[model samples]
Target: MSAALMALTGHAEDRTAAAREWRAAAKPVVGYVGADVPVELLTAAGVLPLRLAGSPRADDGAGERYLGRGLDPAVRSILSRLLAGDYGQLDGLVVSRDCEASLRLFYAVRELRRIEPATALPPVQLVDVLHLPHHTTTRYVLAKVRQLRATLEGWVGHAIADADLTRAVVAHDRLRDLLTEVARLRRRQPARLTGTQALSVVAATTALPVERATELLQRLLAEAGSLPEAEGHRVFLTGSSHDSPDVYAALEAAGLLIVGEDHDWGDLLFHRRVGGSTELALAERYQHNGPSAARASIRRRAAHTAEAASACGARALLCYARRHDDGPPWDFPAQRAATGLPAVSLERQPYGALDIDARAVAARLRVTEEVAR
Candidate 1:
């Protein structure tokens, strides 16, 4: 088998292992963090926390009927899969006001619990993102979080403790540092891993103990050799669910090197973590930094891409979303016109459907490289 396929299978295995690890170690694992939900909050609550978006893609079509807008085939399939007993094992789901699509997805699931009391699916509901000042799109998030927490606490029959939150903060902070080290390895040699492999970092981030993840990263880096020379084109992407190494992979595949980006799963989620703080403090810090609460995750995503274009030595900006994914549309036009850099946009479908032709994307990148050279 080709290295890519083998790696894909292995990556899936790693995810399974990580999820089982988290579930076995911590019950009622929650996967609701977007951009900056605090690990301490979940950890302190004795909940196994995972990022819901990281699950291997499935067909969720049943989710479409309940959503009001932007329901694409991919989204539908994923939701359908969910309703068909794919994620029935989840004890509860935490939804963030991530985007129109995500918000709708959350609503769809939330409604199910209300309408179908006997459904095997776990508790589901919306997460209000406290929108940033001047960005009223998600101002209800804070109240929503508190309410959600209370609901979660009541259901679990135990409230999340301040002390537990503090411990979670320490653990999360360590995880952040550990991920940073892994990012460093990518910066040095983009080929040592792929975007999916990098997802192992994210998977482990939500599941594995920070220390173990760190050791694995360190070991991975030890084997990382120099990046195989590229044709020297570079691009920064802005979109949904980007793992850092995945950013590098898209760039390289498009014949560019990834120097920077603003995707939450890429940078904002992994930006920087405060150290040695209490759980409440740590939760507060995450709430403060995460873009999930931003007025527009799209606009926020765009601005980050704009900034990266200048600083990351990028030759072009790529603003693409997975097919039917609307996360990039909100701020893309403005970003493309204003960044003073040429940009390319695409609609990608998980690891499966890449609506944008690879060669075409690569060709543009090559053109940029030729000019740069």
Candidate 2:
């Protein structure tokens, strides 16, 4: 692997170091939980926006006492980190109602703030954006976007002018377009990029600033292009948002190439630009954002999966979900019917424990691939 690829895989270390330097320089930093929170808004407010991930090594004991055991491990881990002062440098945090866990997290953080004032997390704000496309919902979502933009501006103590927002939008759109190019490489036959590589790039982008992320990705694209294509059964993955590349690594080990996916952390995040004033464009983009199993109707979710699978020319589809995450399973039946293709459902996984059953999943994938052939 190239240095860029290595850096992409070891992004957590890179992010940690970069954040420390950013803080030493007194740069305002904002943390966000979901992909739905627009980076452009934060950029316009003159703050670095860091996407928070659940730590594989974090103990949920501190968090479980407040959120109970029903919350997703990822959520619990984030809460534990917050209580432990792991993200103490953040100027503020924006949590969205992207799923039940996210909504619960907003309340849980609020309660934590009420009870523990000293360890107070940076002011938390909820960015409520519904996926519904009705006019009423559209107006509501636009209003929310405007509200968030104002909130971020106030938090950063910067009056984000129109020019600042326009520049930020351009930067964000460039990042999205570059990622789209990388996705195309992943879709190539004898795939130019592995699932693990694709995922590493995605994870790294979420952590790094837009300009730096785009630069690294450009270098990565060049190196990946010259490499020989890989041979494997092309598979489409649908499941809860993956915070790590464990599942992708496991699938690749099983002789499957995850050419595409319909997850928040994947293709669903790559979308076209909205044309208009910065605020209006942000709202319009948010209103038409792609559907996720957690929030979209089952029919829409199934349609999205089938379309994504077909677009990538995948031989089979794999539905992988964690034990506590039930959203994917709820949408699987409809997706199976919609595709009418060879499909395999992996057993419920322990949160962040993809290695434990990787061999079993690979074996099942082989059977599914053979059936498809």
Cα displacement (Å) at residue 359, model 2: 2.8
- Give the whole-model CA lDDT for all candidates, comma-separated: 0.56, 0.80
Error of 2 at 363 (Å): 2.4
TM-score of candidate 1 to 2 decimals: 0.76
**TM-score of model number 2:** 0.94
> Residue 370 in candidate 2 has what lDDT?
77
Lowest-sum lDDT 10-residue window in model 1: 1-10
lDDT of 1 at 347: 56
RMSD of 2: 1.9
Compared with the true structure, what per-residue lDDT tens digits does model 2 show for residues 161-271?
889889888888888898998898878876888877887788778777778888988887878857668777788988777877766876788678889988877888775
lDDT of 1 by residue, 1-373 (tens): 2333343335434544555665676566665635545445556666666565423354443565665335544345545655775533666767665556556666677777788866666676565545454323233444554666686786678987756656667776776775666555434433343444455455455544444555555555554553332344556666555532443454467555555456565646677675655433443444556443124555564566676567655667776566566556666777776676776667555533454566678687567546656
Which structure among the candidates has the greatest TM-score? 2
